[model samples]
Target: METAEKPNHIGRKIGRIRELRGMKQETLAEELGISQQAISKIEQSEKIEEEKLEKIAKVLGVTKEGIENFSDEAIFNIIGNTVTNHDNSSLLCFQPNFNPIEKLVQVYEENKKLYERLLKVEQEKIAYLEKLMKEK
Candidate 1:
């Protein structure tokens, strides 16, 4: 069985390349003759079949091997290494880390709560400052 990491990497690559090429997910889906949802799934790193991978590679103007061998960690390293060395040509293309929908949702919720707390604190501080100014 393929590890979850692999698909995540492929999805991120698809997203990045599509963005770089100025292609929408809908457009990629059309070129691949798949649904927009399917493209979304691929971009989100959902489990996709081998044939779909081939189609994605073709549509994205990348080689099949390019898509097949990528892993999330590998892609992260590629980005990190390339930024440090400025030698993108030698960097092995990588897939992104597996980020499931559930995980994303959870993270979103956590962030939302944190943001809310920050806002409350700011409001409280402003109220205190305003009261002090009024008293003065």
Candidate 2:
């Protein structure tokens, strides 16, 4: 007699992948056009319908097989190995070819532009309120 293998918790895998991607149940529900409660129920389930699973996989930007084989421990192990070899020397080095002062100036300019835009928006709101008061 052939023995049947136990199935994995596919729903839990999907939920984990969704969480790793920084997606909320509400966001997944909105993308799937379902309710948040429905999403909660799905995540709590051990199995999901194939069509629904496909939809969820697409939204989470992963293949069904990827979710099935996802392991946090494996990811951390890979990162640890990459960071520390047998000798414990660093595998990666940081060398920036660009000038730090130039980058800082660029960031400062971007922030200034954003602040100016916000100030303009506040000024517009004030002008609108003043106009409304004059009308009254």
The numbered model that scores best in TM-score is 2
Model 1 Cα shift for residue 115 (angstroms): 59
TM-score of each: 0.43, 0.57
Of candidate 2, the 10-residue stretch with the lowest lDDT total is: 84-93
Clashing pairs in 2: none
lDDT of 2 by residue, 13-96 (tens): 878888888999999999999999999999989888888888888999988778778777787898888774566344355568
Candidate 2's TM-score reads 0.57
Give candidate 1's TM-score: 0.43
lDDT value, residue 52 of candidate 2: 87
Global lDDT of each model?
A: 0.79, 0.87
Top candidate (lDDT): 2
